[model samples]
Target: MIADEIREQIDAIGIERGRPLLISDADEVLFAFMAGLESYLQGEGLSFDFSSFAITGNVKDADGMALDREAVRSHLGVFFERHTEALDPVEHAAETLAELSKEAQIIVLSNIPLAQRGARARALARHGMDYPLIANEGAKGPAVRLLHDRAAAPAVFIDDIPHNHASVRDHAEDVHRLHFVADTRLARLIPQAEHCHARADTWLEARPIIERHLFGG
Candidate 1:
């Protein structure tokens, strides 16, 4: 089961006691996935509708007809396979996380395919975010709980998806949740989640908010 696999991966990471844990999502948190993906799609003569958050319905060909679900999925796979290690870091993500890492244990919880995990790790390392990366699938509630169980109290979860934030809220209510969406246009489209402590589009604004919650600064 996915939950068992995630638990094994978390246990293998060997959490440090007496330190706060920061579980962050990679796409739109540490790296610009939507932006990079858009560029990649453009190259393939396809584009997004920008009106919907879901990719399958949003991705369209030059004729403006939405691509089939399978085609969209295939395009995503190809995009990740070829461009996983070449993504641009979200603004101030590396610097802010590096500062936070001094006081907290940082772990990247991404929903990328397992095959691209190596490339994602290499990319983060290249961007000076050499932290432990965990590639997961489906809802992140169970995995977040496992990580929280191993770390000190007052853990923080940073992600762009409201569902993931809600999952953490349901599974680990004590953990602080930060809803981060890096793309300005996309951020405007997303409503603030009731469970999130704060919703931010840039790390500059996010850093202070997270610091206050985690360190009481």
Candidate 2:
């Protein structure tokens, strides 16, 4: 769902015609979210199993027992507070986006607490991806739809989550969906989402696909 602050950010932007739009996720798509989160979890005597795409069921303690959602949620809160500003960008993510942004309206639409929005934005900017970062909560369809409505040209949505790909399909079916997972471990665990037009595990592979779709050869 789109938050009020996110709506304000959208209302402030203008998408020029013929310019393609790239709406992307921050964690695991542009930034190394799982990598950072795993290290942070380790600091707290917890570790991620990477058994599945979802987080709540995969984080385990030193004893190898998965923690409940509530506990994991609390740990996540701390993790973001400690590491949001320090997450390493996925290799080639920034340079690719920087190149694309010259010809497209690129937006980082991430599902994160509003408190971490500024930090994430700054982190991306430091790596040369200084686009508008919108903070979202659940099913990113509505927010993607609003952003899509503002564009009169080709649009592409990228994320590591399958449900998000499906959500975008439900709301903005015309937008090209690209499923991207930066971490090889998580990438291996996730199957190709049916709604995604294509999948890329690295930005090197992603750039050409995005380029071909956003601007016809």
lDDT, residue 159, candidate 2: 93
Off by over 4 Å in 2: 1-3
Score candidate 1 by lDDT: 0.89
Q: What TM value does model 1 have?
A: 0.96
Off by over 4 Å in 1: none
Candidate 1 lDDT, 1-217, residue by residue in tens: 3466677778789898768889999998899999999999999999988896678889998889999999999999999999999999998999999899899899999999989999999999999999998989987888888888878566889988888988889888889999999988788878886778888889999988888877889
lDDT of 2 by residue, 48-159 (tens): 9978878998999888999999999999899898799999989998888888887888989999999988899899889888888888889999999988887868898999
Superposed on all Cα atoms, model 2 deviates from the true structure by an RMSD in Å of 1.3
What would the TM-score be for candidate 2 when compared with the true structure?
Answer: 0.95
